[model samples]
Target: MNIRLRSAVAGDYDAVNAIIREGQDEHAEALPDRFARLDQVVAMGWYRSFSKQPNKEIIVAECGDKLVGVAMLEMKQSPSFEALVPRTYAYLNELAVASTHQRQGIGKKLYTASLAWARERGASSLELNVWEFNERAQQFYASVGMRTLHRMLFTDLT
Candidate 1:
């Protein structure tokens, strides 16, 4: 696929939100109720503020006039750690490739673009989160050189 990657604009919000929902559905296995309660619009409304924030961008992948993927990136310093100094890094808050467009390298293209942007902006590292239930996503990230920094575990008490 001939993919064009660029920063998102307000006009791309609905398409971008749909792409995000694709990811949410994939992870719904881990938190079905939580995902169910997310009024899609409210969950995606953060874009209004993210669009205004400095050092933040939402990238959209276009394939012949259609957006097939979207990724959100934020550059910020690591939260203060009493024993260590904070370092700036890029956080990949979200990355979603449309279900029909998977395996065509759209995700990788979006990721590479985000990485280059981070590097150009002086971020020391790039980080992201993947739910344990989404093993495919974890493996994909690993294939792109991302490793397990830590695991977040949980159990149902209900």
Candidate 2:
């Protein structure tokens, strides 16, 4: 299958939202308390606002006339704290492939493109946060040469 990667256009909002919804559904199912299923409009609105940010971008993978995947990326700077070194980095906010098109290497392609994008912007590193419950996502990230930088622990109070 021939797939093309490009910066998302205004017309691609709905397709992007659909792919995002697929990922969101998995998150909601895996951790109902932390994630709630979102309406399409709500998702689209959030996407719209995110896409408008100067330091953010939504990249899409197109197969023929259809959009099959998306990656949301942002260029961010570490806060200026006395204990922390100041640096710029690329954050992978979200990466999702339509359920029908997953496992066909679309996600990997998107990841490669994301790295290139970061490098082009002179980012010191590419970073992201993946929940512990999402083992599949963690495995995928590991396969892509991403190692855990740190872990976030939490406690539940009933």
Candidate 3:
């Protein structure tokens, strides 16, 4: 497969959004209550903002002119709560491979490209979050050599 990896352009909005929606569907399967299907408007708004961010990048994996995967990255500086230094890092905000093309290494290629982009931009680390119940995603992240830096727990008080 002659899959091409490149930065997302304006015309890629719909394809990228579709991939993310597929991701949301996967997440919703894990938590039907908390991860309900997102409205296209909301998803599009978020994607538009991410796309326009000066320090953010939306990368796409396309095969024969069809977008098969997408990964969004942002350059961020974390608050120095543990130390006196503010550390710059790369935040992986979103990543998804087309349902039809998953497990074919498209996701891996997107991740590898994003990592290289982050490193080239002088980021000290790369970080991303996956819901606790998404075992598949957790495994994927771990397989890519990412260790959990923290955990977030929530409880319903109603």
* Best-fitting candidate, scored by lDDT: 2
Better of 1 and 3 by TM-score: 1
Q: Report the lDDT tens digits of candidate 2 across residue range 1-158.
A: 99999998779988988888888888899999999898682366767766688678888999999999999999999999999999999999889999999899999999999999999999999999998888989999999999999988889996
Off by over 4 Å in 1: 37-44
Candidate numbers, best TM-score first, in rank order: 2, 1, 3
lDDT of each: 0.85, 0.89, 0.86
The candidate scoring highest on TM-score is 2
By TM-score, how accurate is candidate 2?
0.93
List, in order, the clash count of every candidate structure: 0, 0, 0
Which model, 1 or 2, shows the larger TM-score? 2
Question: Which is superior by lDDT, 2 or 3?
Answer: 2
Against the hidden true structure, what lDDT does model 2 obtain?
0.89
Predicted candidate 3 versus true structure: per-residue lDDT over 103-148, tens digit per residue: 9889889999989989999999999998887788888888989899
| Global Cα lDDT for candidate 3 | 0.86
TM-scores, in order shown?
0.91, 0.93, 0.90
